[model samples]
Target: MPLILFNKPFQVLCQFSPQEGRESLADYLAIPNIYPAGRLDADSEGLMLLTDDGKLQHKIAHPDHKEAKTYLVQVDGVVDAAALARLQAPLDLGDFVTKPCKAVQIAEPAWLWPRNPPIRARADKPTSWIAITLEEGKNRQVRRMTAAVGLPTLRLMRSSIGAFSLATHPLMPGEFVEVEAEALRVGG
Candidate 1:
């Protein structure tokens, strides 16, 4: 069984199969047997782990394991400390209250690659970046959380999962790398 790390690109589906003429995991990864440990939405991009080992997948995806998933989010408007603080607290989302999470502004640099189609820019409004981490994997949780805090997410990317961080292995949109099971098993 192999443990793999992928730097998922924006608009790419997490599954190996195709979707409605759009890109899928098949296009980026050729390895067999390994499946995504968890998932990143089609609209989001960044670090995703894959494994042929079912137990590893369960450990990573099961909410009870409480694996922290980190994301780099670009949102509409200039987010302030109050909004960041709100994100750090429990969020009432009507259906359920989100668990406490970390949120902080990130420094911007010109080196950040541009999205293929690019995020929409509002002439009258500004945008900001935020780094968020969550233990639970709810559908579109980061985007929803930002919206709940009066900040709409313009772009979202998962930067790291557990001990694997995109910082150490920066990947272009669809690139992936194989990892030793021993490496991933350490932090979990």
Candidate 2:
């Protein structure tokens, strides 16, 4: 089965079709027949898995499988111990409560690429980096959770899904590497 690990860039749509005035996967990926197992918002950047194998795709993307997705997030304000505690706790997001996940303050990753339109910087306000790992994929969940705790996410990038990490694979934005489907295990 054809399995691909793609480093999706900011402002690039997750779909493989063309979109007027916006970058889509078609701009970078020419490989046919493979579809994204999951989605990353156009504003978020990082590792995405694509595959032609339906079974493998379901295993990777389905929330029931509980594959942990790790992100390197840059929030607009300083994240103190209290904020970090809130982040690690199960958060009530109105529609649903987020599952308890790992959250820790981390130094900015030196390997991260700069976004084309840089995130807005406030001269007076400070920014901080944090690592968040979640087993469930929700729509703009990370952004919303941070905002609820008074730390708005400025830049969000998913660094890994399950055991497959962008750091280990080392693909630049819009670049991809193909691997055998069996090489990856769900929830690993």
Worst 10 residues of 1 by lDDT: 179-188
- Model 2 C-alpha lDDT per residue in residues 1-188, reported as the tens digit of each score: 66899999999999978879999998988887888999999999999999887788889899988889998999988889999899899999999999999999999999988888998888999999999999998999999989999999999999998778998899999999987666566643
TM-score of 2: 0.96
C-alpha TM-scores of all predictions? 0.93, 0.96
**Model 1 alpha-carbon drift over 4 Å, by segment:** 109-111, 185-188
Lowest lDDT sum, 10 consecutive residues, model 2, at 179-188
TM-score of 1: 0.93
Q: What is the lDDT for 145 in model 1?
A: 96
lDDT of 1 by residue, 1-188 (tens): 65788988888888987778889999988988888988989899889999988888888888887778888999988999999999999999888899999998997534467888898877999899999999897988999999999999998989888778788877777888887767553335
Computed on alpha carbons, the lDDT of every model, listed in order, comes to 0.86, 0.90
